[model samples]
Target: MTLFDSERPYKYIMDTSSILSQKPGETHTRLVYKSQWERIEEYMRSHSIVTCSEIFEEIKDKEIKEWIFSQQCTVLEIDDDIQNNVRKIVTENPKMIEFTGKSGTSSGDAFLIATAMKYGLIIITEENKDKQMKIPQISKKYGITSVNITSLCEMEQWKF
Candidate 1:
């Protein structure tokens, strides 16, 4: 049996952190039998995972990019609404300077969250939920639902 049903009701907007965290595949680092890999691949195809153009640019790993392409992850086009939301978040909360090039941290975080807000998609990231000025903290402040990869698997009852 495979997992790509295409009728699933949720869309996940992945962050670069989650992309880096997932690597080539969840079980690829381990010994994934061919069938298992196929099943996992099907699961990945079952849902729509999207990210903004900025988040796409943040990823430098070629293999990860290939995998993202294979998974059919949607790279959404950024427009005025998304960009303005990010600017508003940064302007209203200077403490989120870390997301605004503070210490050279890419403003990709703001862009990712802003994309989620504009599209009403759930945020998927591996960032520490307790850290200040990070995705989770800022997401909470804005009432956006943020989750980790593990939580996503759990939500789908995916043992993988």
Candidate 2:
């Protein structure tokens, strides 16, 4: 089954980095910050936005982690196809994921890309385009579209 509505103009899958971009500050968290977070949360709740379930492991901030869980967004599970694609991506580009000094768990970069490939979804990420290992670059190699949150908003003509 498709994760997106066939009638919708655009369908997007978010990477952990892009999701965390809306996170509030540690000190002096203002109302506007909370409002922005809530707005994104509301959008996710109503939209066909999806994200890899593995992102839960990558999230370290308690508030951001909680926000992710609280949202009603669809969390894509890792299937054999996604796993195999992830293997191919990781084997070909080791720098795409940083596993050094960490446990068995790694970043959700590969999973995000694989999911986007599997479902024909455009990736929403915060990684810069200048970086070779970033999602935008790696996704391009696989013929997948990747855009930042700001671009997504502009494309959708969202005011907030």
Candidate 3:
């Protein structure tokens, strides 16, 4: 119930890859994403794992979807500020064009980066930093910190 506490140090926002990769029945030692279902929920709630509606819709796992919806994780809407940031990021990175949908519509990278930048959230995306116009690379230009799922676990100190 305390997903957006101003008292928290930072908000951890996750992308679709984080959901698709880290699901139940996975295994890991240092990272917690591949841990038990209950532990993952506990970790998300305690750490304030926030995400956007676009990213949430990308998740296909029933259990994960249900858990996220019912948990304290904050799912933010795409507001004006986020949309404006997305335009800036997308305009600067033309390479992201190829990553867009078939109709060359909205891209998750833009949304994720914008959300993180506008709200000062720590983005969690599996996209590689070196990839052309990826979240990690674009985040650098916007001065926003973006990390992969494993890196997120390290930052949160989630160990078995």
The alpha-carbon RMSD values of the candidates against the true structure, listed in the order shown, are: 6.1, 3.8, 4.6
Q: Which pairs in model 2 have colliding backbones?
A: none
For lDDT, the strongest prediction is 2
Arranged by lDDT with the best first, the candidates are 2, 1, 3
- lDDT tens digits, residue span 1-160, model 3: 1466457644778877666565444433224533543555665777567788877876667877987878677778898988998888878887775744564223776888888887788887777779756777878887889887667767877674
Candidate 3 is scored at a TM of 0.76
Error of 1 at 76 (Å): 0.6
TM agreement with the true structure for every prediction: 0.77, 0.80, 0.76
The order of the candidates by TM-score, greatest first, is 2, 1, 3
Among residues 3 or more apart in sequence or in different chains, the pairs in candidate 1 whose N, CA or C atoms overlap within 3 Å are: none
Backbone clash count, each prediction separately: 0, 0, 0
Which model is ahead, 1 or 2, in terms of lDDT?
A: 2
C-alpha lDDT of candidate 2 relative to the true structure: 0.75
Query: Residues 8-30, candidate 1, lDDT per residue (tens digit)?
Result: 43477888876676444652232
- C-alpha RMSD of candidate 2: 3.8
